[model samples]
Target: MTLKFGDPDLEGLKFLQDDPLVITPIIGNCHVMRVLVDNGAFVDILFHNTFIRMGYNDSQLTPSDAPIYGFNHMECKVKGAIQLAIIIGEEPREATQMLNFQVVKAASTYNAIIGRTGIHTFKVVPSTYHMVLKFPTRNSVGEARGDHKMAHSFYVITLRPDRTGGQPAEDLVPIPFDPLDPEKVTYIGASLDKPLKDRIKTFLQENNDAFTWTVAKMPGIDPNLITHRLKVDPTRKAVKKKKRTYAPDRLEAIKKEVEKLLEARFIEEVQFPEWLANPVMVKKANGKWMMCIDFTDLNDACTKNCYPYQGLIP
Candidate 1:
């Protein structure tokens, strides 16, 4: 599905909204907590709390060092991106998907945003309206362990104009959305199972206010702005800076670090328990352990946040 701007034409857009884009808060390097995925943001991570918590007091971020933007549509300061581990999918059948997210600093509850900047690096095709992510698998179907097949695959919303003619006038901008308001959110995930997709579509249809946001953290803009631009980093220029040392420590510390790094050679990521989806059990299957989350009654009772979106609120 695709979305187009300017003039009325239903054939030009497939309005897949970014409902509840899979937002994950990952804890890495101890005391480092931030949201791993925030679909709205094109680039730049704002981590006001993270920097404070990490004991980097009185240090200001460099805005010109690297261009950063926010929901307010203002120039934002960007710190560097540190790697983090984010558990993908729901419990029982869940798997660990290591991702490299920008260490964003923000004064809001929206910690560490894994923007499209990081997502585009991987194989992702998003069906925004359905709230489903179509990502690719890493390992081949044969050598795959357990039910795991896909690598780190995340999808994005593409506003494609309708190939079929004869329809109503459509919005000439990217789908409008409110990240703060629970009601205005578009749900995104791995699948659009019948029940889930129906629930999502019902929500979108019922709430005409539901739309997508291209520039997260920006405030106040014409609702019709469709010429959205994502921050683009020249891969060639960035790679010119040769790799830096991990940490200068004792030989013993260095050896241990090296070994640990080697073990995680396949994926550059961090590890944690809370990231595990299902309730872990004691077992050994083909020299591997079973990890899963029991998302039974817990999800039903989960309460929404308190912040009501400023403009989105009727």
Candidate 2:
């Protein structure tokens, strides 16, 4: 079935550009609001405040040690994880799915974030420009429109220092590894003692080549040492995805990244091959665009290794 967005989808939304798609969905009998739909996120998140407000006790959460990193590269402590049934849309058109959410204690305007895993479970197609989420139903397509006003309000709150409390002044401090080039630096704990800090600086200065400041500085491993080969099923038909167009800003970012890779000799131009995929652009928390190739089709055709390498259990 064909699912498309048109002028009708933008009927109630305000003409605010760059607004995140925020929706209110029914979670475990409660109508939860300010849930951000982020395709970039791998796992669904539930804020500690919202988790408590939902009439859930701490005992209900299963202990987990998995680390969750934010766009700033700082780890967000996970209190635990819990599975909750979430109902999206309304009436007969709605779809229900039990989702696992990682509970975080970080202060934020969003109560929850529905990530790629949840989106895939519901087979959802989200459009930030239209501010709507469309999913497949039994008969027809079901839509859950976003709250533009709430999104705008949350975005405004994010810009305010009082709401977020900002970062601590002494959290981390840059320590220059090279005195001649002050720009070549690394971060260290600001609370470290003078002797320890001096030792660390000395150690880093001695091993300056180990730190890769840029992608161009990386000297990749030799293929003869360890090479990776895709075990694609010979019987499966090769799929070539259609080229997708991107916005001007995203297009420029992709072009710049591709040029850098070319200069670094990491990627070379190739003619039409059997397998083809499109590139995806994700906005980083630091206001930078990260380009990633979509390898879904390629992965589907590859055979899974039954005897995969296993790590030691702790």
lDDT of each: 0.39, 0.83
Q: Which structure among the candidates has the greatest lDDT?
A: 2
Q: Evaluate model 1: give its TM-score.
A: 0.31
Model 1: lowest-lDDT 10 consecutive positions: 142-151
Candidate 1 lDDT by residue in tens digits, 89-155: 3343233445544445434434555567645643344433333444444431111011111111111
* Candidate 2 similarity to native, TM-score: 0.55
| Candidate 2 Cα errors over 4 Å, as ranges | 163-314
Candidate 1 lDDT at 67 equals 57
Candidate 2 vs. truth: CA RMSD?
13.8
Error of 2 at 305 (Å): 43
Pairs in clash, predicted candidate 2: none
